[model samples]
Target: MWRDSFRLQIFCLLMAVLAIVVLVHNFFQLEHMDDDTISGSNWITENNVQHSLSQTTKTTRKPYCSYKQQTLSKREQAEQESLLAAILWPKPPDGKIAFVESTDPAHSDFVIVKPVRFFKVGDELEVLVRMKDFQGKPKQYGGDYLQARIHSPLLKAGATGRIVDCHNGLYKVFFTLLWPGEVKVSVSLVHPSEAIQVLLRLREERPDRVYFKSSFKSGKYSETTECNVCLPGDLPVCNFTDLYTGEPWFCYKPRKLSCASRISHAKGGYQKGLLTQEESLFFQSDVNIKRPILSSGPDSVIVKSKAFT
Candidate 1:
């Protein structure tokens, strides 16, 4: 009975040793496959990345956070302030809104109200602009961004005109006749008020809409990944900031290459879906943006020389 008991004890010890070996083997296998798993997974979201802290002794990893933003990081706070700044920024519009992102430059018109038979260089010229929509309906409120200038191609002279918004869709442009002979007026809608709002949102929320990339090389091995001024989430990043100028830069960590291996950088591409469908309507190339308003009556006025005054 004693010999049988001793043999059973020896067998139990061997089984325990075998169990430990299997556990250690499985652990290393998981570690080996970790990078491949992360890379193959769709781990990124609109504003965050879902990734656990990688196991590495050479690099720092953020503590796993099940709850995001319990305490705002400096980046989070800065993002909040940027969004707040958009609301606090000063702008013109002490009136109501006629439409939302509907200013059509093609349907808009400007006219020379007081056309004089003869004008001298010392005189001031005035022009009236009326804002309209694609349907040709008059805009009742102000706040459309405009650029106005008076230029004489023959005289090779040009000057910007001062614009005054009446808070009602009408804008008055005043130009001082400086070396003018056949001075022509031009008015362009740089952006509609609602489109400006969309821009402000993009500035506050998705400043990294235009992304970039970088390449890392170690011996014959190379890896490339996207980069930006700042990246989202707790995913690992390589800091490439300029210490002397205090300029900050960062890039997404490569799967195989270390941060120290980064050698080259270049533009990636514009991030998709930065704007909503409604907001995208404001930025069509052939639409209202940077389009010129037609002259209703006369686009040019002749001015006499100062000596002729």
Candidate 2:
């Protein structure tokens, strides 16, 4: 009976050891499987993160590339404009002209004529004419023909002025006074500048012609007027706004009359194409209404025409 009991205890101990071994092996296998699962999940998460980063990089770079393209396009456009300006710019004027002065061949903003009021017989006189644009801006381009004349209405004496082109918009007029009694100096354009004419033709819709104001001393002045170019026998009246200033002017002309006649000083009156420098200043000034001048001296009577040439 003692032997049998010892054999039974040994069997029980062996079975318990076998069960513990099985449990330990199962635990190690489970741990290894869990580690593999964790590693695979981490790899998948890393791949997802890398893909997201790639997508983000692509999205951000697209705008950068587009901006670079836009910058290049603008630079090219500016270069093209510069090239066109250099190529298409008009050349200066040169030719033989009678009773016209072309001095310096360079352009200026204002004309200076000295000793305008008082003069003696055989006294040499100088007159300067400046070329400017419609906006009262100095014109750098030159190619205009100018002519000058000095005559007295009361006297039989008259003199012709010599013009020297400065190659700019400026011209110098040289004349010797033949008579001293109330001599009138008049300058007219022998020929319009090709460049300026082309510009005017291109901007034909605009009224760029300069006109003198009638009764400027009486505080009554008009600068611009509009004319219609309709079919024959149509209404002659028209209204238009100035392109540069947006100021409104009105005029009327019958089919029998020229369109130029529409720019008369007063209604149904003849118009003159002379704008004095002082009167031009009045136009260029910031003042809205035409202000009356206190005519105190002969300077008020000295008329200087301001033309584009």
Give the winner by TM-score.
1
Give the per-residue lDDT digits (tens) of candidate 2, residues 1-309: 999999999999999999999999999987764543323212212112111111111011212112224333587779868987864533544332111232221222223365554555666777666664444454454556555767776657567888776756666878776654566666655344542343444344323243222110111211233222111223333333344432333333222333332222322233343334432332222221121211112311132323211
Prediction 2 TM-score vs. true:
0.30
Q: Assess the local accuracy of residue 221 in candidate 1 as a C-alpha lDDT between 0 and 100.
A: 48
Query: Cα deviation of 125 in candidate 2 (Å)?
Result: 0.4
Q: What digit string (tens of lDDT, one per residue) describes model 1 on residues 1-309? A: 999999999999999999999999999976765534433123232233221132212222253322223466698789878988765532434322334427889889999988988789879999999998777887766768899999988768899999988867799999998885788999999998667777777876776888877666566445667776657777787766555543446677887777876666666778787877777777776786898998989899888888884
Measured over all alpha carbons after superposition, the RMSD of each candidate to the real structure, in angstroms, is 10.7, 32.0
* Highest lDDT against the true fold, candidate: 1
Once superposed on the true structure, which residue ranges of model 2 sit more than 4 Å away at CA?
1-90, 93-112, 195-309
Off by over 4 Å in 1: 1-101, 155-157, 218-221, 242-247, 256-264
lDDT of 1 at 175: 91
Give the 10-residue window scoring lowest on summed lDDT in candidate 2.
50-59
Residue 179 of candidate 2: its Cα lDDT? Answer: 52
Instruction: At residue 204, give the lDDT of candidate 2.
Output: 42
